[model samples]
Target: MNPGLYVFDFRFTEYFQMTIKPLLEEGKDGELIDWLKDISLLRRGQKCTNPDCQGTKPMEWKRARIVDKFHWSCPLCKKKVSIRTDSPLAEFHCSFKIILETIVAWCDGISLEEYTKENKNVKGVIAKRIYSTCTAATDWYMQTHPELTLLGGENSVVLVDTYPDGCMTTTPHNNNYTKRVLCVADTSHMPARIWAQLIDNKILDYQKLAAVVVGHIRPGSTVVASPSLYPLLHGVKGMAEVISVEALMALDPVDYQRSLKNLETIWRTTVSVCQDIQNTSNAEGEQMLRELEWRQVFPTPLSQILHDLAAHATAISS
Candidate 1:
């Protein structure tokens, strides 16, 4: 009897420093700042962002002190930039420690409100950002990825569908209505190959669906869609379409059954994950999309998610 890989894992920090550190070590601002730098997210200097230094300053790093907490000195221009000059969290005003703590809370999967109670030094918005920027980041990921420029390939299959994302609770000021979002995922690739647009409880027609998906799909792959989508995609060129169960039935029965089975598995997982989302905010749809990507890469409870977050947040030199 051997345990699986996750069973004996010790790769993640089991205790949050802010929550459990006082009992084990000194809790002070200086220590916290050192910890932030140790994670590799914050640095003492960075490449100058000055507009005038065009390509000439290939590797010129500026050194400047940030709010007296960190130093960033520019060697070429002799001007100082913020330590967080080029990372994702660069624009935010919160301290580096708060950002790390907020991210940890999010990975732990407790509501943002609860995390605040444990750490008085953090703000609600910071914790909320763990949930907030995901959608934007996801959109950013799609726009930046080369494969997403054209979504389809030799053996690609795309599954498109929309389902209710549950209704908001009744409040005196709010009406109860079920919200929906568009899910067009390329099942050909394992996890990162998906895009979502939140419709705020509204549904899209077939023509609109085809238009949106066609751009993301590649030039020469077969797309399998529902009967309702057939009319929308009939004459679309540079791609092949398999529309409806009837169309699938026309194929070899053995292959058709296998296809149906795979389709059900993928669709069910997507829906089930979306449904697990507790917050119905329009932003959460995108966050869920991003979380899906993270889960695929890390593949565990939120702690593993935190490991990746810490790595990405701290490892940038810029």
Candidate 2:
């Protein structure tokens, strides 16, 4: 089946339930692998790496009952290469079902335990590796997509806040704290936009926080933040005009409520993500937040995400 026919806004779970699960139930694994190749998740049209072939011939995919499940075969030279030989999936030694299911779980924000509960065949370590690959894809998206990375412009208003979090330390008795500075760009029409960073320093000085925020926000937009941030952000070079949350609340209640509404959503969602965060070290917390930020920024369906990963496969590696 052509993947284009499945281009709808259904959630990943729904798609998996309706499409992928049936394929597995019917034992049509090869067709599923073909679909993955169709979406570019598995490597496609790759040239054989055998020295005898001299990269002159395209490799054909051959399905087998091998550990990798698939390989790329050169007809002329009779050489074979693993389907994941040079792709981002090189290090992954799991089935495509596990890999795809892991992507769905990651996108749906399903915890590892929850995912394993539903799909008992998946081992925790393999699932974690897939989750890491998803994070790497998000990091690549943030680094390369400037339009999504930088928020706010001309008439936009960005709601700003800081979240206190604990970081992990190697010393068993020592602990460290960091601030997660979050900026939610509210355009009043478009879906909310977000930019987040974990400040390495413990100090939450206005100047330091403002400097970090200013870089992500565009000029001419207004920044609605707590009073402590006013002085540093109000008149900084190339920075947006700053307004205290209280003042914005009083002067323009509609916009104020709108910004607050978005901020509240972000806070509530992130707080839920960090609820059991005390058990996890700071590094893990940051990864969770980064994953959240990624979902907010892209908000694409599983197919689109797969296509994106395939398109930028070289940049995102295991």
Assess candidate 1 and give its lDDT. Answer: 0.52
How far out, in Å, is residue 180 in model 2?
4.5
Name the lDDT value of residue 97 in candidate 2.
67
Error of 2 at 133 (Å): 0.4
Candidate 1 residue-pair clash tally = 16
Task: Summarize candidate 1's per-residue lDDT along 216-237 as a digit string, tens digits.
Answer: 6776767665555556665778
- Local distance difference test scores for all models: 0.52, 0.62
The 10 consecutive residues of candidate 2 with the worst lDDT sum are 165-174
lDDT of 2 by residue, 1-318 (tens): 112211333343566678667655446777877776677666667786667887576877787678666778888887877877766566667877677767776666666666677887788888888877776676666667767757777778776665442111111321342334344445443446666665555565667677777877788777776555566677766545777766754654663465445455545544444343435667765665565566666555565567556766765343
lDDT of 1 at 151: 54
Model 2, TM vs. native: 0.73
What C-alpha lDDT, on a 0 to 100 scale, does residue 226 get in candidate 1? 55
The candidate that achieves the highest lDDT relative to the unseen native structure: 2
> Which residue pairs in model 2 clash with each other?
168-282
- In order of appearance, the predictions have TM-scores of 0.53, 0.73
